[model samples]
Target: MKPSGTASAHSDTFARDHLPPAGQWPELVFDLPELLYPDRLNCGYELLDRTAERFGDDRPAFRSPDGGVWSYGELRDRVDRIAHVLTDDLGVVPGNRVLLRGPTTPWLAACWLAVMKAGAVAVTVLAQQRPTELATICLLARVGHALCDIRSVEDLLKAQVPGLRVTAFGGGAPDDLTQLAAARPGPYRAVDTAADDVALIAFTSGTTGRPKGCMHVHRDVLAIADTFAHHVLRPGPDDVFTGSPPLGFTFGLGGLVIFPLRAGASSLLLEQAGPKQLLPALAAHRVSVLFTAPTAYRLMLDELDGHDLSALRRCVSAGENLPAATWQSWHERTGLRIINGIGATELLHIFISAADEAIRPGTTGTPVPGWQARVVDSDGEELPDGEPGLLAVRGPVGCRYLADERQSQYVRHGWNITGDTYVREPDGYFRYVARADDMIISSGYNIAGPEVEEALLRHPDVVEAAVVGRADELRGQIVAAYVVLREGAEQSADSLCAHVKSELAPHKCPRAIEFLPSLPRTATGKLQRFLLRTSPDPHGRVALE
Candidate 1:
């Protein structure tokens, strides 16, 4: 296997050669040979097949927070048993959608694997999601049955969506469907599924509006593993993978489940992976590779003064842009570069990422292998290097929003138009500018809010910063900043605003600054800028000229 550095070099080379000229649409280069399967197969079965053949009885495949470890052989056995139970006992079969609700645990992993292995579509809902969100997702997915943690059954019951058979795992089940691993037959055969058959339905964060389910086939899992893990992480069998992302998010799905299994590595699944829980888990597991978002890294840095993080070799930052200060601080403390990537629910996982050796702090780096990226104008015309425009991508796995006509809007003319603004350097590195929706149009000048946020993050007193566009009577919309200062840092609004104006363009600086104890974020750690857009001091009135 190539070293991480070598893989990044190959990716840089491909990006250099394939990226379109300034103002031209990007042309992708497909180098992979044709395959027997036109679409991808569900990865749960593929994982079972690999483990059963190679290290079935050897290493532990999953380690749960409760100190339970399941060997590959045991995991496969349990998955088979559950598959049989789902098919024979519950009457679930191919084309049926099964709702899975639970925390990130070994049982959740087993349930996810079993559902797909049984040829049923798995719809995973975040355990923290309220009853209304859960009910909407269940109704939208047309879920016939649900496998959820016993602790969360009350929430499901409150949703009051009738006719849905509920199966309780982790705790004793008193419901219609229960854990049948002990009683079900172990010799279960997987149903033959087409490559295009839907294996899982992941819901997008409703940052813009209501959440929509993003449909993905079995092939997307392996495709993401091959593109991101093979080309970016390059994990070995001995590598211990762990992170803070919830299992419900595709980011966690790729990092904790699919990537580790694809590379024959072991993963540490913590029931609670907040900053308070992550440090001890990483130390206890001797985790070598870490995957999390940029915000988590910032928080971890604060808690790592005397922590022994010597075991970590690579740390991946995703879900949002990685600030240069966060990257620099992490490297200075741990001597490890944080590999930043840009992924979406629509893409299923990461498409643009940087490996350790080739990491360009503050930039999202080049595209992963088998994927193509470009910065394009409003009309889909390619933008010149150093020019910010909307980002578009094409790869083996693309967005197929479930039952939504907006799929056409996201996927236009064979290119998935990811609603992100970015600038590509002449050397092929792509820097994240901001979300397309978060762009501030002030007096006809286009400004990416994230650029200003990054500038604020460089200030020593700043712990966290969020930038958003605020409505302005004169400028149409102006930049606004919400900041969380470090402990003992003064919260003088004027000084902070002055600091930002000095570092960034006067027009790009926050027209107002709001002090906060903490900024709100999604479970995946993405900054919730929409909340800031509606704030009372939307335009930073305190510092207005």
Candidate 2:
């Protein structure tokens, strides 16, 4: 049950061995080379066709929470029918953007596939988003047609965006996707999309302001499947993939859609993915590969004693840093090491992750194959090993943010500066420091909020924590901790503050603590530190804080 020996064993080879002495790391393994496309088509339609042909009707291609299963042949046929509906019935054509809003159900998946098959761009919106946000994304993407779930129609109607044609899935006939699938053609030719043709437009959380649409080409999906899947997950036709990420998020899209389809594997889509729902679903579906965030893993470990997780062979964690404690605890309980990676919405998917056998606790292993990364100073000069600096990367797939000057600021000299501070070791592993904007400058020392939060999580009483800089008259800014304690654990504010002081360095401990019932999170389950920074409880309004 030890950290290194718990999962599938492999060699201890480190990425440092492959690093170049001068400029960048070369010969990194990527995922795109392993795909099987009919002809040279780069669209997702080709990927689905290849999967159907390879797997046929052998097993389920997709499964739902209620045990509804669709074989590859059945799924492909439905996708074709939906494609016809998109083109002939709805007047959708190639080059148009179709806004797709729904949960992670089979219909959503089918609609997404059908959109790409019809040669239109698919713009995915998170199901949990409010009507305002949904409308904002729809307008930004200039969507004229929509394929949505029955539940989300109310919200869409409330948004009242004009010139939008709506079609519901799961309900019967006319507008319902089920009836359209039954009546439409079973076989449709795949669109011959170019590699550079835009396939999807994913919007980021836009913590600074309005969400920015990230345009990804057909090649990007194939590139991610080839880079991450071939090198990291290494999934096969028999692997049963399951995850908690929503289909709207790139993490979910890559793990649940691209990875499984490219590998000819089956995936389970859960409309709700809390620990309660996920644990039982894992057992019922016999999911072999699990993809989720660190917080969910910690929650699962707390409640997974009797669950049959023996079927789980791989667990991938992203969205946030994975604590060494959570990684070790899960491995001990489930005998699976959670593969940790650092991916950005702009980058499409994971560009740095550890292979199963090469995982090092507390590190975002190495640059993904075909990608090169370096820690550099503000001037873009590469820093020596172990020096904390801005993490810059150059890879096959890069960011093209929607009409934002910030994109240029982030992408400099062909290397995309992730705005994250990191420390590169002699062994080629990168240690996350802090987001450039999130670093707390207190008394001339740079304090990383996430690092302090990670330390706080090691304490048994603390269930969740968010650390940010608070305004201070003397120090300009001081570390403040917003903590959520475990159930049945009671501690005074003073005592809890003292507990953190005892566990961490005096300077690193929070200057003040605010006990909260729960931490604020984005729809994707990422902690929202921006909200915490603006709170008066931390400190009176101050620029640095």
Candidate 3:
């Protein structure tokens, strides 16, 4: 057997070549032998093939909003056909990075499994991204092939990077995976991949630069399901899952796809799921499980008077802090205690969470059964309970940023330092403090100010732009941007905000945009972010230069 440090000379070897050095990686722990996976593991085989084998094909696997559903047997057959299409038609082999762009749909889910099953890395990009954003991802991941929904063809075409071969699916385009899969005959054999083989490269917006790629392996996929979903969530086969988060977002990926499928259950896919649509869909599909951010829950609170969500057995909230008031308000409206937890794209899914019986309001519950978490000081020493410090976690899964130096900063002495400040209580619960960096956490979404600035700069009118988090009473923080327009530019705040929204995700849009003739800068012309942030509040500006 090859050691962990050696690379395999396989067709899909981009991820292996970009992994962090073995010594710099966060120390991985598999203290629990029962949950330990074999050295060679294929998550696609374990999550889908094994589930179908044991459940006897009776349970529903996935259902779409348009009244379409597939049983385990049907899903298995379809997945194999798609896997054959990826290999035989697209020439995809083990370890290749495949970019997927589209809304959350059954076909998208199938493509994800198909790519993994064929021993390739799945890179899911949001359909809302503009061509420029899409292009950046293509370059960063060195994506060999792409699969996009027909609706996204225009953007996909515009984001063309050399060497990226894109195939369109859904809406029956000539190059669709659906058509290809239909023509293929398959009960294709799954690829034999090691447990540490990279299966996904989830991107998180960068605070100081372009978006960063977080690599996760085959075992990391099962570890999330085995530890958190198994011990905390405990969803049964009869459970039906539904949510609003995009499949590109790890929070949504775990909530909507991995968790349910791991439990031998099903998920309801929706294109758009604001409160108005989510409530009725819940009643229509008899959704038993719900996953969304605190923002959505807050919006749905006022409309709860008439919604029939009695069928919902569990509601999981993440992507932001679950305030006690929000928790109390939710419990007051519906008799369900919201399952709140914290997870990052880097870690793949939730590692700290508490379910109904064990949940404590206002606190993110203790570490999951298979993980260890603690508060640490600047020197990386553990802090006593009740002292706010950096949150460091070590478990079956840890951060593996693709070839980024930030990996060193994130992982210190074998522990993953999630850049959040927290205080562990004497009773073993963890209380949220604030983000350890300059990141803006708004409406349960992480918004990097520099990324917003980069998006703002994409507009022709903007010459200089600086973004920062403004304190907010409800959403925690809002993106507040200061911009300097180019000569003869007359862009309104709303129009400029819209331009940013078009370039980036909706959550990253600037809520308060102020037009300034000039911005504070260092002697070397670097942005003086501290001055913009040192104001008395979101409304106050620092002493002008």
TM-scores for all candidates: the values are 0.92, 0.91, 0.82
lDDT score of model 1? 0.78
Q: Write the per-residue lDDT of candidate 1 for residues 390-490, one digit (tens) a residue.
A: 89998777776666657667866567899999999999999988899988898888888888888888888898888888788988987778989999998
The superposed Cα distance between candidate 1 and the true structure at residue 155, in angstroms, equals 1.5
Using lDDT as the measure, which candidate wins? Answer: 3
Clashes of 1: 4
lDDT of 2 by residue, 160-189 (tens): 788988888876657587787788878888
Quote model 1's TM-score.
0.92
RMSD (Cα, Å) of model 2: 8.8
Global lDDT of each model?
Answer: 0.78, 0.78, 0.82
lDDT string, candidate 3, 195-267, tens digits: 8889999987333346789999888888898888988999998899999888888878888889898899999
Please give the RMSD of candidate 1 to the true structure: 7.4
Please report how far candidate 2 places residue 298 from its true position, in Å.
0.8
After superposition, which runs of candidate 3 have C-alpha atoms over 4 Å from their true positions? Answer: 1-9, 205-209, 438-545
lDDT of 3: 0.82
